[model samples]
Target: MSGTAEDATDATTKRQRRGNTRQRIQDVALELFAEQGYEKTSLREIAERLDVTKAALYYHFKTKEDILVGLSQDLQRPIDELIEWAGTQPRTLDTKREILRRYSVALADVAPLFRFMQENQAAVRELSVGESFKDRMIRLIDTIKEPDAALTDQVRCTSALFTMHAGMFALRDVEGDPEEKRQAVLEVAIDLVTQAHAGAQSPGKPPKSS
Candidate 1:
């Protein structure tokens, strides 16, 4: 019994090591892709950067596009899960706020992927990045916007989503901490969703004074 248990532990450790190696390969590949254009990066260069043989890299990922697709999937999975979770929740102000808060957290760690996607627009479009993102945005918007909302209220909901997306790139040159800017952007997005929700709930009614 002890031998069996020891073998299982060894297998688990080996699996974890393999997973870490795969992740490292993906990270280095993305870094190289960002430094140079994706079109200019090659599998040999990636292996060189990692100090690994091409055969070793091939044992994990078969191609450069495969690495990219893996990275894209990793980035998309959280938002996909968030959209699924939001779909099952009651569409209330609190839910919208929570969605925005959760989204802000999701976007926070995705800066590298975001920068890579922006620089390699054509490559991103060719992968699952483009449509997957659009679908998630649509799901988020539908969750936040009321079925009977007026045009302006709908715009507010849409704009709130776009604001988070823009904040990542727009404030890159501004003179403030990244976290501070993220908080400011999240506050603005939450405000937009809150106002849109209130407007939809009470049509033609002016906002209550603070």
Candidate 2:
């Protein structure tokens, strides 16, 4: 029994070590993809950066696209959870605000991935992850916007989502604390959603006389 227990512990340790190595590969690959364009980066370059043999890297990931897909899967998990949670909640102003706040947090967590996506737009679009992300955004927008909202109000709700994204990239070079910038961006997004919600709640005004 003791020998069996020891073998189980050893197996667990090996799995943990493998998980760490896979994560290291993913991190190094993302950095390389960001430094040079994704197309310019090679699996050998990623292995060289990690001081690992190509075979070792291959054990975790077979190609550059596999690395990217893995990264996207990790990043998408939180957003997927958020979308699922939002679907079960009441579509009130408070719920919308909370969604933006949570999304802001999610964005901050994946800032590096976002930066890579921004710099590699064409590559991202060509990948399946890009389409998956777009569908997720549409679901999120539905949670915040009224189905019958006016065109302008709908724009406001949609803009709220983009505002958070744009803020991350726009403020990259600006001087300030990272958390502070995130809060500021969240504030703007909340304001836009609030405005759209208010407009939806109010009755339409009569046309003015000529």
Best by lDDT: 2
For candidate 1, lDDT tens digit of each residue in 1-210?
A: 999999999999999999999999999998999999788999999999999999999999998878987888766888888889898999889999998998888888878887788778887777666777777778778988998887888888999988988888788789999999999999999998898899988987865556
Worst ten-residue run, lDDT, model 2?
201-210
Model 1 C-alpha RMSD vs. true structure (Å) is 2.7
Clashes of each: 0, 0
* C-alpha lDDT of all candidate models, in order: 0.87, 0.89
Best of the candidates, TM-score: 2
- Which residue segments of model 2 deviate by more than 4 Å? 206-210
Per-residue lDDT of model 2, residues 1-210, tens digit only: 999999999999999999999889999989988899899999999999999999999898998888888998876898888889998999899999999999899889999999898888898888888888888889889989999887778998999999999999999999999999999999999988888888788748522222
